[model samples]
Target: MTDTATPLISLTWTDHITGRRGHLVVDRLVRGVASGGLRMREGCTLDEVAGLARGMTMKEALHYTPGARYIPLGGAKGGIDCDPRAPEAYGVLVRYLQAMRPYIAHFWTTGEDLGLTQGLVDKAAAEAGLTSSIQAVYPLLDDEEAARRRLADAFAVEVDGIGLGELAGGCGVAEAVLAALDRARRPYQDTRVALQGLGTMGGATARFLTRAGLRVVAVADAKGTVANADGLDVEALLAARDAFGTVDRAALRADDVELPGDAWLSTDAEVLVPAAISYCIDSVNQERITARWVVEAANMPVRPEAEALLTARGITVLPDVVVNSGTNAWWWWTLFGDIGADADEALGHIRRSMRTLIDLMLARAEADGTTPRAAAHALVADRLPEIAARYGWYR
Candidate 1:
């Protein structure tokens, strides 16, 4: 069995100029290729980076198909333990990229996550004299287009006349939640959902679910939680929210009710989506979560023991590996599959892949009489030996 206890490579570096620290965790290497995101947030640590790296590895393994016929890129993650609001943050990022230059070129390709922006990422790559390693993944692109994209990436311009990529976690989670409801023979229109963390992923998820005919009764962000029994106006909420996804308290309608902190946990809802951060549902709060379906749109959003407790209480927890996989699906398709210049087509491909994968996991879990997480890990275990042999990582 593949050892999950240790990462293949874990490196820590300090920016002597600013006294900032950075970490890069490579969970595994397949054909010497690894890829993940670079996240910058206050209080970030090496251990969190390593855990996220491992999640990426599991995500790739769970989605792998033998017929794809390519060396699966292993998982890696990078983190900067600095307040993004600080003036020295940009300098710290540049220096961190410089320190990681060798690995970034030879083994790892990092992208934006959390507090990192595309412009900052491109600036760092330029400062480090590195080309777009992501281009290496798209071998099927026409020579002219490939050259054009490389130029665009080098100049930090739009590629194929499109802007930077977006987080599709919400799109994937919405599809997965639908798949889960369908499996349980529940009606989407009749379902009420309480969402925590109204940032990029959470905001998008709430919008999609509301559009899909689900009632988003409660929505929460770093600021606070707002609820309406008859369902909140998602479009209006989106209009009132800031770039960070915090809803304005004054924007609420007369009928809207402001709930206490953590009140979303006790809200009357059939589905709960935690899209904010890790361990949102822990030992103390797990007991109060009213949703029967907990769809995780954030990595490791549910603690292990909390997940167990919820399961015992008859709550079905859909894991992040399956529910929040839209971004990964988008990357895989852009690299290997034929995604043209259309954004809708690209998103459609991701939604379809997520639905298929969620269905497969649900079926497997049902057949094995186990949780979805366990079923996913079991599939990963079964595929590890084959993947290792295919890549010649082991005999």
Candidate 2:
């Protein structure tokens, strides 16, 4: 099915400075605008960006709230093929954004994704001659200036040293796990989690889950797996990290044992989070997972065949479309006045919305004897038509 769905528009560009390629796929548009994020990484491909664009479509539709100010927009995604660590990466990024300026001006509102940071996106967008990365959605706002200010203020707020914008997605992920465990009657203290990638999403997830009384037995970074039979000090590890999300070995406690990069999959834990790169878990590596649940904090972390295998093994897999929709939803919620710039209020809203969405997805999964991803697609199937009927497919 994925091989054949035609998008509304697809674009590709070759960076003039570095010759790296970039892509944009507007999977669908609502009210003349679509929303998604831009990711930069080596080996990025048009097909990968296309798949992510479709995922954004499902993500937007899944958050449809009737009578709410924050109506979900259509889905889109952009990606650049270049190592974000390279010296010429920023120049390539500027040229890519400049090439995508028209879309950013009128159709696609975006910010950071994998291998890129929010601040980096903002700076590059500015250099690309755009006032804001999300300017495309400005016309939809009742008060554009007020909305922009609100969003900026939200980005400024911090909770326990983490920016609110960075915390939003992870907060949603942790709440999804908590809600799933609640349905299974599992105690938080007994649930041990081993996550891959201690980046923005992974780090914030560790912080939230740790506060919720769950034991984080292991965490994986670019370096390797940092494991302890007992929980590690999440805050100290979070503080000593560089911009690339690589946890410093100097910060490791005496009890912390470093393992191979792939060792996180086999760690003794009830829940496993793959918050890093895509296609990491395939049919082979999935056999190493003993976790009861695999919550995808990263987009498309688990391959289709691996997900099937995980299901066959009686391990629940929470899909990314529903699990990681929080950051995008939070953006619209604040911009549309459903919530304000306050960190506590933003976190509360995320927790409530994510829990509700997770509950609905799991309940439908139970009723249909299907996976959460399937159930989420079913929900999107139902919601998209309702949304389209209210505000036609294209404005």
Number of the predicted model whose lDDT against the real structure is largest? 2
Scanning candidate 1 in windows of ten residues, the lowest lDDT window is: 155-164
Q: Over the stretch 1-395, how does candidate 1's per-residue lDDT look in tens digits? A: 25667888998998999788999999987766766888888778999999899888777777777775334577889999997768998889888988888888777767767776556787777886777535334443345465445434423322233232443567788999999999889999999999987776887788889989999999888767899999998878876776556898888899999987688888999999988777778988998987889999877889999999999999999998778767765665555544543456766776887888899888999999999998888877887777787775521
Deviating ranges (above 4 Å) for candidate 1: 1-4, 69-71, 133-164
RMSD of 1: 3.6
Per-residue lDDT over 1-395 for candidate 2, one digit per residue giving the tens place of the 0 to 100 score: 12238989898999776679999999989898999999998999999999999999999998899888998998999999998999999999999999999889999999999999999999999999998899999999999989989999999999989999989999999999999999999999999999998888999999999999999989998889999989999999999888888998999999899999999999999999999889899999999999999999999999999999999999999999989899999999999999999998999999999999999999999999899999998898888878888888877
Candidate 2 residue spans exceeding 4 A from truth: 1-4
CA error at residue 3 for candidate 2, angstroms: 14
- Worst 10-residue lDDT window for candidate 2 reads 1-10
